[model samples]
Target: MKRTSSLAIRTASAALTALLALSATACGGSGAPKSRSGGPVWAEGQGATEAVGFMRVQTPAGAAEMKGAVQHGFQDTTYLLSFAASTGDAEAFVADLRPEEALRANIPRDSTTYTTITPWSHLGLPEPETQQKVRTASVCPPCIKDERRSAVQSITIFVQDIGDGRARVYLKAF
Candidate 1:
């Protein structure tokens, strides 16, 4: 009886080991798959080309505001912008700007596929303080490999109301 019980225990242990191995394999193991683009998974969709153009045209006032808000050294950086304005005006500006394709309106993860917009916080960046509200948008352009890609590659924009109709806008690209 003792020998039989020992054998049963070993058999159960082996079964458990096998089950764990199988589960890991079925779950794709650990770590994300290597990406060729090296950009975030969210960076794989139609970019913000039209949106940027629209911002440039519609928010000339915001652009002027950006002149003061942009850090001096970072001004030459591509796909980065900052501005300050009234909260209502800033919200309206963001609302008016639309991406050519539908953007996912949530934070994305490593497993996130192409064609989605994750929140700014997902990038592990510090969130700015706001008195009233904060808004953000993420875009991963679809034509990442296209030569004529005009949109911001992988960008996130944050708009926050500082109070008294004043707001701050910040854009970052990955």
Candidate 2:
């Protein structure tokens, strides 16, 4: 009787081990894949082509040196991009980005709760504390439709004229 009981216990233990191994394999291990678990990162000197790939706007042909950052959460990716264009291009640049259209640089979007979580400090772009003398254009997806709306569900853009014919572009999309 004792021998029979010991054999049954060993068989049960073997069966349990096999079950656990199979379970792990089917669940793809105990952790999230590397792609989904990546952390936030910043990249500088992004060209017009690369910057446009991440956002909905087409920077001017003469857009200057650009900066970009990406924060990858487990479920979504937040993209931040900054560049400078001639003040003349600011109007057309914000033409399509209308949801938050006409935002002023004086407000400092980074300090606001309604604006993007990505900060201007990260992009090395300063937020001037001037009044609404110069209009800033802000736009987004679905709020204002466009062909560029295909890839992303959310976007917010701000083009501020910082004087001297230079306008700064701050963009966030996911």
Candidate 3:
């Protein structure tokens, strides 16, 4: 009867929809992951607005400049922020950070070279072309010794003594 045909058609349509969904998933998705945005975003500013918008922190005393940029990959997002302040401010900034274990465990206690950041690293912050002195630290709840990884969140800190009683702080979070 018409009732049985209608029931059969409804069942067939449901099964077809389920099959198509499974097939799409098994084939590595339509294109991009569903959990993230469809495209990458990048931006930079001369002061703390952009950086602070992405992070939670007070502008340090004598903050000369700050920049924040983000790169959203197919499955991951990276945020970069930097600021220039007095040496005392830099030290305080480093001390104010919590859970420095990941940085402590990282090798090369310190360095005199600028942390290598390219367009891919910082979306192009104008770092001084020369090295002075740099102190580094990082935070990643899921990171382990010899292997750096991110879980829900991650942060990497770099404080460079650009001399003249000023230090530049760079932060990377994802």
Q: Estimate each model's TM-score.
A: 0.37, 0.56, 0.53
Task: Please give, for residues 1-174, the per-residue lDDT of candidate 3 as tens digits.
Answer: 999999999999999999988887876689344564455555434234644555455668678777667666555666667888998987776665554553332234233454543342343554433334655677654553313233336667777777899988877766
Clashing pairs in 3: none
Stretches of candidate 1 off by over 4 Å are 1-78, 99-133, 141-149
- Per model, state how many residue pairs clash: 6, 2, 0
Q: Estimate the TM-score for candidate 1.
A: 0.37
**By summed lDDT, which 10 consecutive residues of candidate 3 come out lowest?**
102-111
Q: Provide the lDDT at 23 for model 3.
A: 80
Which parts of model 3 are misplaced by more than 4 Å?
Answer: 1-48, 102-132, 141-152
Question: What's model 1's lDDT at 53?
Answer: 48
Model 2 Cα lDDT, one tens digit per residue, 34-55: 3433455444544344546867
Computed on alpha carbons, the lDDT of every model, listed in order, comes to: 0.49, 0.62, 0.61
Residue pairs in clash, model 2:
97-139, 98-139
Name the weakest run of 10 consecutive residues (lDDT summed) in model 2: 127-136
Candidate 2 off by > 4 Å: 1-49, 104-106, 109-117, 127-138
The most accurate candidate by TM-score is 2
**Reference-based TM-score, model 3:** 0.53
